[model samples]
Target: MSLLEHLEELRRRLIHSVIYLVVGFFVAYGFHEKIYQLMQAPITFALKKHNLPTQLVIHNPVDGFNMYLKISFMVGCIVAAPLILYQVWLFISPGLYKNEKRYVMPFMVATITLFLSGAFFGYRWVFPGSLDFLFAYSHEFRPLIEVNEYTDLFLTVILGLGISFELPILVLFLSLFGIVSPKFLWKNIKFAILIVFIIAAIITPTPDPLTMCVFAAPLLFLYLLSIGVSFMVHPARRKRLKEAA
Candidate 1:
């Protein structure tokens, strides 16, 4: 395909993705209250564990509606994630060989699964723990967290975790495209570790060592896993081994 054709195809895919997101948005909006309750569970649990007030505050008159809208939008994005991923694959599949293109199902499944797993990990473990730690000072000061602010923080942490968990998928694609190999990753393991810690430090909401370790440990494991994945998928690695055999 010509450059113009590729651009047009990308535009079409984006439009389709947008449509899917919009549909998901409306569906999520219909259950916005339930979604809000679900998201608030972590905070509620934290508050109860700390014996603090379990209610979030609203500073603005429109904060409640705005929060609902935000929650719906987030839920919509999550609902439409598979479609968006499919569109992404469609956009790039034209550049791949038939054999490579056959990975579409696996790619989508892995992407979605990793994302949800990361989100669940954040919500179930990281968020509550972080919230409890941050609110540990409630005995000295009254805690009145605004609904919007809480939502923003929650989304930032959850989304960051979700995106970070895609490291393996990203590495797999890079290996498949011959951009990096298992040997290269293994050789640069030290640098990768340094980068992973830096990213974990940035992504972790708190400066505590434990939280940082929580984020970094999985990432380091994923890096090693990616190296193994690269050994399996990298064309040069396969070719060299085949020749040796």
Candidate 2:
């Protein structure tokens, strides 16, 4: 395809993705209350555990509606994630061989599964722990968390973890395209570990080492897994090495 055609195709895919997201947004908005409750559950539980107030404050007159809208948008993205990933695959599949294009289903499934798993992990484990740690300071300063601020932080952690969990899939694609190799990843393992810890520290909501470790450990494992996946799928290099041997 010409450059213009490629650009047009990308535009089309983006339009489709937007349409899907809009549809998902309306659907999610219909259940915005429930979604907000779910999102607030961790903080609520933490507050209860700490004997603090369970309610979050809304400072502005429009804060309530804005928070609902934000929650709806976030839930919509989660709902449309599979379709968005499918559009991404379709956009790139033109460059892939027929056999490679057949992996689209697996790619979409893995992407969605890993994303949801990471979001769930953040909500279930990390968010509660972080909230507990933060609320512990309420004795010094009264806690009156705003709804918008709370949701913003909540979504940031969830989305960050969700994207981080895609490390293996990203490496798999790079290896499949001969862009990276298992040996290269292994040689850079130390640097990768350092970067992973740095990212974990940045993304974890709490300053506690335990929370940071919780975030880093899985990422470290995923990096190792990505190396194994790269080794398995890099048949061209493997064949070349075999011939040399």
Candidate 3:
């Protein structure tokens, strides 16, 4: 296909993505209350589990409305992500060779699975742990966190963790495309570690070491795992890998 044809295809997919997002925004906005309750559930459960105070307040006049709007937008994006990814895959698939199509199904599945895993990890483990730690210490202080501040912090953590968990897939793709390889990464392990610490410092809002480690540890492990995947993807395997390693 010509460059003009590819651009046209991209334009169609972009339009489809926008339509999905618009539809999703309305559906999600209608259920914003339920979503807010769901979002607060983990924090509520944590406080109850540890017998800590559980009230979060919003002092500003418009904070509540703004929070609801933000939540709706976020929820809409999450709901529409699959449709966007599908459009993206469709747009790119036409250009791939027949042999490459064999891997497309597995790649799509792995990508979505890894993303959901990250979201679950952030919600189920990291969110509660940090919230509990932060609030448990303030039991006697009449804890009153602003709703906007709390959700902003919580949502950022959730999104950051979810995106970070996509590290393995990103590494695998980079390796598959020969952008980087296992041997190079292995040689620069120390530098990678430093970068991990730096990313953790930047991503996690909390100053607590444990919270930061929760983000950093899996990233390091995923990097190592990506090396194995990179080796697997090279067309000339076994002998080439042995020589390269």
Residue-wise lDDT of candidate 1 within 19-136, one digit each (tens)?
9999999999999999999889998988888888899999889999999999899899999999999999999888766767888999899999888888888999988888888888
lDDT tens digits, residue span 59-110, model 3:
8889888999999998898889878878877886775545666776787777
In angstroms, what RMSD does candidate 3 have relative to the true structure?
3.7
Clashing residue pairs in candidate 2 (N, C-alpha, C atoms within 3 angstroms): none
Residue 6's lDDT within candidate 3 is: 85
Q: Give all candidate RMSDs, comma-separated.
A: 2.1, 2.6, 3.7
Higher-ranked by lDDT: 2 or 3 = 2
Query: What TM-score, over all chains together, does every model reach?
Result: 0.92, 0.92, 0.85
Q: lDDT of model 1 at residue 106?
A: 90
Candidate 2 lands at a TM-score of: 0.92
Instruction: Give the distance in Å from residue 153's predicted Cα in candidate 1 to where it truly belongs.
Output: 1.1
Q: Please, what is the whole-model Cα lDDT of each candidate in the order they appear?
A: 0.89, 0.88, 0.80
